[model samples]
Target: MTTRMNEYKQQIITDFNSRINYDNEFRYRFAKPLIELAQLKPGQRVLDVATGTGIVAIAAAKIVGDAGYVLGVDISTGMLAQAQRKVELEKLQNIELLEADADDLNFDDNSFDVIFCSAAIAYLTDVFTSLCQWYRFLNTGGIVAFSCFAETAHTASILFREKAQIYGITVPNPNATLGNPEKCQYLLQQVGFQNIKVVTQQFGFYLNDAESAWNANANSAYGYQVFQLPPDKLAQLKTEYIAEIHASSTEQGFWHDVNSLFVFARKS
Candidate 1:
């Protein structure tokens, strides 16, 4: 990762944290699959890495019942605050929230029965390094599950790349950690995770109208690159992107599509 890429990613995280409220729509679209992939069991010890607003942690707490425990970790304090509030509101004593970097967890070896990461994997500067840490955290026979946006499934990202070319904005190369399932598999194998399996799925959000489409993009990773542009240019980009979405939408509504891959592996 070059300095340029790191800067770009920081800007993205900052913008996304600011704009995207944890709504029911987001939980249904992103958290549902992650929960399913986690295959949680009662009395299991689960670690929710990059836990964001704590949706998956909360879900895991329920699935694991009173005997189980869920630990949620995130780098962003704001996101963790929201997660803690949810914990308090739900009176969930089993879930613990912490502010920690995913790549370098401060825990003893083989501490967790299962570890789960969601869309935050794409933002990792070195996903392989983080995956290695996760591998170390799992007890023997324990599994690690995560969901990431597959590069193949991100139509908006591709569209943004094309648009960046047309507009002469010097957007950096796509993050190496993004939506490529084959590469992800190889990285997992390299980290000594066995019985690896990867599955791809598509989720589409049909915006109520063009305005809703604009709002979603503005709050998402795809739009972060163009977010800091001058107001007029930003407006122009939004308008053009909205038009592109409207033109490509299905009968349901304007479609914002992303490809997410579920990966599961074990420390042998």
Candidate 2:
């Protein structure tokens, strides 16, 4: 990647980690599902791919306890640094965080007992290739779980694109393929995973009053324009974006129409 692209990616990670607070509500509502999918057990070595902010890794460490170990890997140095700091603050020696790309993981085959990827899957350059590589890293019967927004899931992507249009910035593909839950199942099976399961879920949040919801969409990878926008226009974008949401708010606040898929499979 060019330096500019690398910088942009790093900025997005920094912005996301900076703006969003992963509180109990977020954990129970979102992270918990991914953690449950991890199926972590004591004394099991696990890896968290694209572990932004180390939330899943931290949760896994608690589940695996001291007997097992959890390692989180991400591509952004800044993000990894923040995750490492959080791990240290928690004094979790059982968990390790590293800077690495999901597309090219550096580990031996059959090394991990469980592998999990959270919302980060969409950012991967090749989702299937990464799935195959991660599958190779899992032990026989090892489980791999990944979650992504379903294509039909509607939330802020539309708002983001509309805002981008106002800014004259052409954003690259969001990298998130929300299109086909079945495709996720097929990829796992093709990669030699058996007992494949694909589940879809809907979680509604009051976007009218939630700051995290707004920031998660505006500052995350979904909001590419936020990263590319010049400093002068950032405040404008933020203002207009928030206004856009409030403008549509009703008595219950704006409802976020989010649909996600959780795919689980085990290496044969």
Candidate 3:
């Protein structure tokens, strides 16, 4: 990997490691839909890329039964440790957790019957190339499924980026590459996947107050870009972001749109 790419991966590892103690209920919910889209069968080999906490992997193991196997790979040892503990507690002998980068995985061609990546594809340095790698690892007619957010989703992050631009600082949108259903379809098609399908679902909610929204955005991976700023500038950005949130708030509260897209395709 290039020096910049290596640094990016390190950043991701650090970010996730720090989140080991945080509640993963959101990720668990996000991964469940991908499991349904995968439609895994008994005895089918499965791969879960960036399988943080092994939520999807463990679920897949249950559905696939004892005859099948699951390999959940992640870059964060801290996350993997949590996953391992869960697997052990469940007594799931069919699942294996590995500490590895999703982009650098190596396996024989047609090694898996199903592949899943739940809400973690955006962290990839090269989304298309990674999808193509998954395509090569799947058996003919095998399915690959993943979930991502729409560009318009996460109003807080969107507004933060907009406000940051006024300060001459550019914040990258993680969902820019595969934000919509159409973009997801085109990507799978280009990777030689057939029987493609993209499902859109709104999991939007209202934050109780502007402070809640600000805290959510500031503590997330999206906030990494602004961390390098001077403390005064960062504080100013947070203040401006909170003001924008208040301006946009409704009677219910600040709306945070979790517009999710579940994309599935077959390697044919």
Candidate 4:
């Protein structure tokens, strides 16, 4: 990996380790639909990359049954700890959680029957490099499925970037690349994947209030933009962001829609 890429990986590992470990009610929402796109069968070996808390991995293990095995890998020790605990608690003998980097995975070529990633692909600094590696690791006729935030997914980041522009600040959002169907398909095709398909899901949840909204934004990759401001400017930025969410709020609560792009590709 290039120095730049390695640096970004470390940044991602640090930022995500805290919030995603025990995401009981929130991100776990994507597990079923993301795995359904895989079309997995019994006794098939599966790999779940960046498997935060093993949501996708554990779900796959159930479908694969005892004859099959599922490996859930992540760079965060904290995340793997949570995943291991969940797997053990559920008595899922077929699922294994490992602390490993997704970009430079160390697995034999053509080993896995299915590879899945959920809401974690954007953190990969080099998309093509990693997808090519996944293609190599997947067995012939194997399937690869993953979910990424659709272009319109992160409304806070949209507001962050929008508001920042007025203050002469430019927020960088790498997640935007996989937001739409066209971009997702083009990347998969470049890596020699066929039968490429995308399913769009709109998962809108209600935040209790503006504080809840701000905390959600601070926990994800959007936090980078939140922290970019100087200490003096940060207070002002927070005030603006809180109001941004409140402005979009209704009498019940603040509403945020999470659009997920579930992409599936085949190796054959």
TM-score of each: 0.84, 0.80, 0.93, 0.91
lDDT of 2 by residue, 243-264 (tens): 8778888888877777778778
Candidate 2 lDDT: 0.75
Ranked by lDDT, the better of candidates 2 and 4 is 4
RMSD of each: 3.0, 3.5, 1.8, 2.2
Query: Once model 4 is optimally superposed onto the true structure by TM-score, how far is the C-alpha of residue 23 displaced, in angstroms?
Result: 2.7
Clash count of each predicted structure: 2, 1, 0, 2
| Model 4 stretches astray by more than 4 angstroms | 1-7
Instruction: Give the alpha carbon lDDT tens digit for every residue of 211-264 in model 3.
Output: 766665565556566767889998898898888888788888888899999999
lDDT of each: 0.76, 0.75, 0.87, 0.81
**lDDT of each residue in 8-105, candidate 1, tens digit only:** 55665575467447657766567787678768889999999888889888999989989999999987777888888889999998999998766567
- Residue 258 shift from truth in candidate 1, angstroms: 2.6
- C-alpha lDDT of residue 235 in model 3: 87
Better of 1 and 4 by TM-score: 4
Q: Which pairs in model 3 have colliding backbones? A: none
Worst 10-residue lDDT window, candidate 1: 170-179
Q: Distance from true position, residue 242, model 1, in Å?
A: 3.2
The reply for model 1, stretches above 4 Å from the true place, is 1-13, 170-180, 211-222, 227-235
Better of 2 and 3 by TM-score: 3
